[model samples]
Target chain A: MTSLYAFVAGPLAWAAFLFFFGGLCYRLLSMLRQVRQSEPFIFSYMSLRYSLRSILHWLIPFFAMGWRRNPILTGVTFIFHISLIAAPVFIVSHVVLWDEAWNLSWWTLPDAVVDVMTLVVVAACLFFALRRVLRPEVRFVSDASDYLLLVLTAAPFVTGFLAYHQWPAGPWMTIAHMVSGELLLALIPFTRLRHMLSGWLTRAYIGSEFGAVRHARDW
Target chain B: MNERHKEPSEIMDDGVEAALSRLTPEKIQAVINSVLKGETGARFKAYMDTCIHCGLCSEACQFFLSRDRDPHYSPVGKVKQTVWPMVKNKGRVDTDFIRRAVRIAHTECNLCKRCVAFCPFGIDIAYLMTVVRRIIHKLGATPLYLQDTAHSHASTMNQMWVKEDEWIDTLQWQEDEARAEIPSLRIPLDKEGAEIMYSVIAPEPKFQAQLIYQAAAIMHVAGVDWTMPSDIGWDNSDMAMFTGDYEIMGRIKRTHFEAATRLRVKKIVMGECGHAFRSVYDTGNRWLGWAQPPVPIVHAIAFYYDLLKTGKLRIARKYSHPVTLHDPCNVVRGGGLHEKARYVVHQLCDNLIEMHPNREHNYCCGAGGGVINCGPPYKNARVAGNRVKAEQLFDAKSRGAHTLIAPCHNCHSGLHDIVHHHGIDLEIKFFSDIIYECMEKPDGSE
Candidate 1:
């Protein structure tokens, strides 16, 4: 079990980070090249001011009309995203690993807080899964992969939470958590999760079009 | 769930029906592949990749809201019904699928960017729908009436097929009408080096000649040097843009801009039409490789706002009726003239009662984006689909607003249909219609 954990936490970890960062850079650079070749005029319309304005408005919880209308979904989304980033980065074990690897660290969240954050992420993923199955509008657009992505997103948090509490299958849960988390990171650039990278760009394009050209707010 | 399960009305469009009759699987695959591969680039790919399909855009759409929150009418749902299938199947969709796609893209959706505003990632569902339209256009399957308008633009450089002589005669006729009110008034035509060149959609010459007369009176009263072109470019509206016939759209916009260039006008002041403003200032110009319009084009809302702000046009008396304003999507959301429109309304009217979700967030009139030009075949569905807008109008009327001041021409027509169909008793007027009645004229009229 320890050997398996070592495999996942060592070589698998490097491969996932390599694919995540490298794949994102490739996708972004190729997109830029494609834009330059096809619709180079997009660059002329892009404005930093509008981009920041749009991004800031959307980033704030319930700031956008879309967020305001779907109160339940909005609440879940904010909790999920905040937990998704914070728990994974600020958890003591991960920070200690980072410190041991490169001698770098940031302020860490209390383990108790991160524990609750992890459970919130797990609950949010379940809520999203239920929504995909139940909500007509959401179900119409979702497919098998969407469900699979939800499971993939939740697996790490669920397994991590179980491992942290040292549940019945503690060591196995730790390996499962590391593997699922690494797989999730690696798959992001190739899936709908690519929105993490391109969402801001899309927001910037729309904001510039609305703000600079149309003289309207995008959000 | 039962409400969501309602089937879409299968409106019989002869153009789509006829095109489907001629289309083979290979032809469908060919046109879809060509557009997807050749025309679209990074923006297309990025939008496709970035959408998480959370369905937040559904509420922003009137179709979805009016249809009892039917998922099929949601902006994302519309795209899923149209473009996603083509992309997933690599353009191998059957004729029946194409027919449904035509209906969804052309009839069901308005291409208003309200969904764009509401999306967290700012996914442009309008752009995706237009792609579906482009493929349909290549398949020669655009709705019959809209295609006829595109043909008119191709042949006459105008949507209404108004002949050169007829256009000039319409201006002269309006000039005569305005002259009866103010004897010295002139609808100046073909005047070179004019300070402003005024342009209206072809509908003005075809039917709404009175709007031209009102515009002439306003120009005369304001003491502005404005000329109307008695040429092919007099019409600023482009149905071709909506038809996905970019070639014809580009040609129409080019002629319109060249007319202003030829006249040496400082800017072209467009009549109150939202889609025409979008065609000239946004879509058509971008297609023609000009990021901004070649000649500065001002929408009627902005022009009137400027005239009022500069004290060039004075209100002799404020209109007494409590009125509400319908913000057209293109000019308000597309042009950001919401506040200015309110200022003009307040300047001209005594009591300005605003509709809820006013300004840039207003519901579309179910007309702009060429849906109204789809004509009578789809009118029932179009009117029925925007029940939420009817509710809004009713709510405004209940609040003591007896009149609706819609500045854009398409909004006036669409709102007229909505009010009539929904049994909402409200008088509709253009800002110019009220301005002509309330502004101080040189003849001391008003």
Candidate 2:
């Protein structure tokens, strides 16, 4: 059991991190290289201002322009992503594990906060999955990989929550959670999860291109 | 048969049907491979990798919404059905597949980029669709009417095929009419060092000579130093750009800039044509390797705004009808002139009834992006696909709008169709129409 956890938490985590960061840098640099082939810069001073303003505007999920239109989806996605990001980094149990591994630690979220976040993440993941099943438009576009990605995102949290609560098969659940988390990290660069990096690049390009080239405000 | 499910060849003329028959799978594959491998780059790669197929973009598409929210009409769905298979199979898709791709990419989507605003990642779906168009164009599979228009551009340098003599004659005729209004009014031809060179689409000379006459009066009243080129570059509209004939698009735009450079004009003021403005300012200029227009160009909305704001032209009496404005997709959405356009509208109009979702979020007129120039074969389908816009127009009419002002020429035609086809009673007018009605006329004075 210790060997299983050690394999997932040690070598597997390092490998996943290397793949995630290296693949991300490679993709971004290649995209930047293509921009060099674009027509010469019209050099609008307003482009920089608009791009920065839009970046700040769209950063908050609630503050994005159309959040009110799809409140429930926005709410669930907000809870899912915030908890997904927060519980993995600042939760007390995860911090303790990190400190034990590398003598690295930071301020920890309260146990109650982490527990609620885990439940929210698990519930939100299911909501998203069920939506794909029931919503005809969404269902039509979704393929097998969409469902699989949702499961992969939720598996770590579900297992971690169970293990943290000392549920049945406790040690087994911890190792499973570690493995699932590492799998997600490794999948980031290769899958739609790459939107984390590419989304920023594409969004900024839209704002900058509109502002600088057309001299038009997107908003 | 339901309008949505009708086959492409059912609507195609014999010439286009024969063109489709001539296309071989190998030719299609070669064109698709060349574009995917050469024209596209990492930006394309990023967009493809990042789309989660959430169907949010479907909600933004009028085609999808107007068709009872059919998933097949979604922007992402359009890409998947048309471009994705070609990319995955390395362009080995068959002729039937290419036919359906031409209909969807060319006839259905307006390439308006409205979906870009609604998308979380701001994926420029229009750009992807244009890549599909470039491939299809190279394979010689464009629809006949639009292809004929593109050929006109290639041969005569104008979409309407107006002869060089006919173009000059129309200008002289409009000049004579304007002189009747203000006897000293002149439509200066090839006047070197004029501050502005006025350009118009070919339909002006062929069908709507009165627009030229009105513009001459406006220019006369504004007392602007402007000239209309007597030569080939007077027609600013490029249907070739919409057909993805980049070589022809480049030639049209280059001739325009060269004419302006020869005249040493500070800028070119184009008439109220949305797609033409987009060609000179955005797509065609980029194809010719200019980041912006070589000489600055202003759309009619901006030019009108300038004349009004600077007190060169003033409304003598506001048109006192309950009116609403249709925001042309290319200018309002593409050029970001919504605010300036609204200012001009309110300046000339009284009792303005604002439409729901005005400005950047406004629905497309279903006529820009060469969808109308795809011509009469698909007119019913185009009008049916814009039922959402008809609903919006009805809503505006119920609130007391007697006239719906559309500033772009294509919007004028498209909105006119929606009004006529749907039996909606609102009158369609361009900003130029309303401006000419209300503006103070000169009495042979400065």
Candidate 3:
């Protein structure tokens, strides 16, 4: 929350900004341009509905309503997503930064709770990585890019744990955490993780809308 | 209302056969390249630049998980093998590429777009595959059976070439058969200003005409106002979705909508079909450029919900049969009609056996997106691809589901194969059949 902290957060914040702004602008512009150039009919009764829903499906995971068939993976994935998403927002540092910078006054969890969630996130990521590696089908399908992303994801968690523990060295630990966090922000928009924003656009909204409009029988 | 015309047979095989022989390699390549050129040769370029290769999309794809994580079966890999080569070469790929892309795009992938759900970014691999299909169509490299279906659309305005008279005859025949069951069932055709204009894929008239009979009995019992066009729009299924024939797809959608419009109907109701519903609602209609359908288009799930909610239709007896529901990709996940479908199913069947992954997140029946229409050669592979689904069914069966209610025709067909292949010994029925059998009639004869 201090000027020094703000200064340190500058690069990390800018990296998030790039994903939030640059990544978003590029995706939206490209999709719109595709529509513009596509056959005019693509804009028909169902299309406008499709495009709108596709654009609106970010920030929500409505597809988890079903929990019967793919229960193990679905349940595990949902927990992982919740913990991973919550850690960054609910952590004390994130809360304090928001409090100092934006006058936000949401509750900040105690360090112990934050640490537990961070550990939970790391565990879930590891589990997913292990599944991807060990499962014959998953492993066979997984390419170098998958392993790279998993390792990259673990880097921040590893650094965060080291920094939290403040083992052996202090400044080095903090820098490590800072560097990994910055790297994660930079990598997000460039890789398949970019779908975090677009998946909702298609999966939840347009995906459903198209299904609804066409009367494609599902249930 | 009229005299017996002829047997309900496909109206066009000769013309399409003639065109098939003339389909030279040069013609096929020319068509494939034209579509590739349409995007400033940048469509594939953009796609390659866009992928992040995080297997997060694998979670979104049923085929990938169901297939035991075969890398080549992964959605991104699908793009890699089929379209990536063309994109890499900037469109100088040979016929071999065209031949294989056809199989991968049309036969292998179900176009469920479920991967779009789990995608970290919203890359619609379904849409990308569609692009590949378009290229295949242009190259004239489409599979034989699917090509025939596409030709059916181009010629008769319906995929199965059910002539106008045959469509009406099929309706009358269905009504006659249904009347034997209920003594008052009727299939109204070309009835103006009906509350619902019902449409179906040509297969209903061609092979599964009994569905029409069952639907008429359900409508009759419910006292619902519905009509079917005695014209081309009567065939709601669109092969354009399979062949990547946007024009045919669009025309089919417009014809369906316009038929409803012509009748001054309140809404267009589609039967149980996955890709057909997708085509009308998401793909084809969009190709024709409408924000939403001109008229409200309701899936059979929603329509039945309206009937049951209004209390116009009441069950005389619960079906007493134990049943499981197969969530067709288009209606359940894509349309969000899972809860409604459950209500109808549970009301009609005495015992409801829940599939492990019920509703939107359920496995595809392996026949949707015209995968079944790819024909018998790929049948075993299709079943193999859905080995996970078979296991899911067996798991549900262990809980005692003897009958399966599949609302979509494609699901019915696909699930039929899975049930047989898995040796589950389950009987498949449409939701309408149960409604017809159990719902009380106006006369209270039941």
Candidate 4:
């Protein structure tokens, strides 16, 4: 990794942690101040159990054979997700940086695999982005924030790839990728990314709660 | 043979078809503007901004799949149909667009809120759809039957005018019938100091009186200390939750919580319905600025789970038939009851067939968020729009599910029509009915 890229990435990493945590708190506090559910179970020990199981639900597919439901969307989402997980793991720069930060190490994949996964992520993100802009079904409701996130997402991949080429890559490109990547990380807690961690409880509770009400068997 | 092609002018359009042409621009813009203003703020902003497309919601939407993959019927298409028009025109769209928006908002899509669960963003497309319906409703563009229900709620507390006497008489009748099943079972009405107060929507009295009977039987067998309020709040479900009439929604929710408070009950046990449960716990309760119900409101699903988990209720006769479940948007997604439902189902039924994408990922029963409240005039359209759900049920039927158990009132009603209109020969059962049937009856009459 270039010294300049590392320097930029270092401050950006701390920036990511601070922004995400601070923003999430600000947003959550605003929500609490506004639409507070007074008797919301402070002690949802049981609900917590349900949520924990759900967080690891998608992990099963990577280790096991298949999914619980619609194969097409599940499969597409799985491939996309797996690609994302791989990009972070295989990047030699990321591996060394994480090792320095946390004193942890796993085997890093070969450079070829790293490049392949990054390319896949780029393609996948493009698929989603194009759908947002071209499809009227999507275009109708989408706002500037939607477009902003799409462009924000592409930044990491674009900068990373350009740096990989290193021909046209300069400090600006590397800096842009590192900065955008950090921004996205920061946005995760405050933005819709909470859906990933929080969706399990919300979705499962909704499913099973209604299931019990209807006297249905499975959620 | 087929004398079908009557000339266009001489066709003599009547019913909802005739009234469609009479729609005016003045009415349309007023309603659209009002709805836009009300549906502002964070929830609206997050919803508008979170789409990256990916079209995963298309598969989850019954309308899109049902309409032969018409992009127009897709969940996203629904937004484009209604909101996009308003947005593009800066809230200055025409009457024809308004008419289409009314159909799309009221009938084409149910505000089941199922799409929100599937979307990675949790964008709450259902809330957006409701906002559109709220606009249409203001314009008097809503279909006749749903409008009538709203009117009923406006004048009478209940959407169905089961009068004061009718309400009490029906409860008494149900009590008497249930007493025959379990001699000591009491359907105590307006009893003070009870730990739990029981409530149901108006449909339970107006149409499905047997639900009251079934619920009473279960309460008796479980030996739960409960009382029913003979007052305005007795009907806990509000159709205004669908109609976007927040004022009426607040009134309905207030009446429900107030009635339970009047009875001095520690908690309220609502009957088997999701949206109603949501109204008290999530939507209307929030609308009225109550953080939570003055009395903790429990849906029948939660009550059943507690009864079973506590070993208070046991089934001597397990239901042996193969059964499938429909996820009601409210209790399932909104309240998070998927596992508890599975727990009860495994305990009660013999062979349970899983719906693909079950739980939070499941498709809506198509009656939720007030889609059913849209009424009979749009019945065929509702059924038509939900062809995908019909096919999903058909697939479950092929997998050998002879019975479908839907826990929520709206889901049951919606699934009933989908099953019938599609001519699927399957029986629909509510969990309460099954719980009542399978539970042990005490040796004497109440």
Question: Ranking under TM-score, best-scoring first?
Answer: 1, 2, 3, 4
Number of the top-ranking candidate, with DockQ as the measure: 1
lDDT of 3 at B168: 82
RMSD of each: 2.3, 2.2, 8.2, 7.0
Please tell me how candidate 4 rates in CAPRI terms. incorrect
- For candidate 1, the share of real interface contacts preserved is 0.82
Worst lDDT run of 10 residues, candidate 1 chain B, spans B1-10
- How do these models rank on DockQ, best leading? 1, 2, 3, 4
Docking class of 1: high
Score residue A75 of candidate 2 by CA lDDT.
83
Sliding window of 10 residues with minimal summed lDDT for model 1 chain A: A168-177
Q: On residues B1-446, what C-alpha lDDT tens digit does candidate 3 reach at each position?
A: 11122111111223223444566656655565677766432234344555655455665566776666777777887887876667556566555455557667876789876765555345567878988877766655566788789889889988887787888888888888777767766788889989989888899899889888777777777777899888768888887778777788888888888899998999888887767777777667666767666777788888888888889888888888789998888876667788899888877877898987666567788788877887766677778778888888898888998888999888898989999988987889888888877888776445
Candidate 3 Cα RMSD after full superposition onto the native fold (Å): 8.2
Report model 1's TM-score to 2 decimal places. 0.98
Distance (Å) between predicted and true CA of B382, model 3?
1.6
The candidate with the higher TM-score, 1 or 3, is: 1
In angstroms, give how far residue A144 of model 3 lies from its true place: 6.4
Candidate 4 on B219-263: residue-level lDDT in tens?
Answer: 777888889988777888788877777788888888888898899
Could you give candidate 1's per-residue lDDT for residues A116-157 as a string of tens digits?
999999899999989988999999999888888889899899
Quote the lDDT for B64 in model 4.
73
Off by over 4 Å in 2: A37-47, A61-65, A215-219, B1-10, B13-15, B444-446
Ten consecutive residues with minimal summed lDDT in candidate 2 chain B?
B7-16
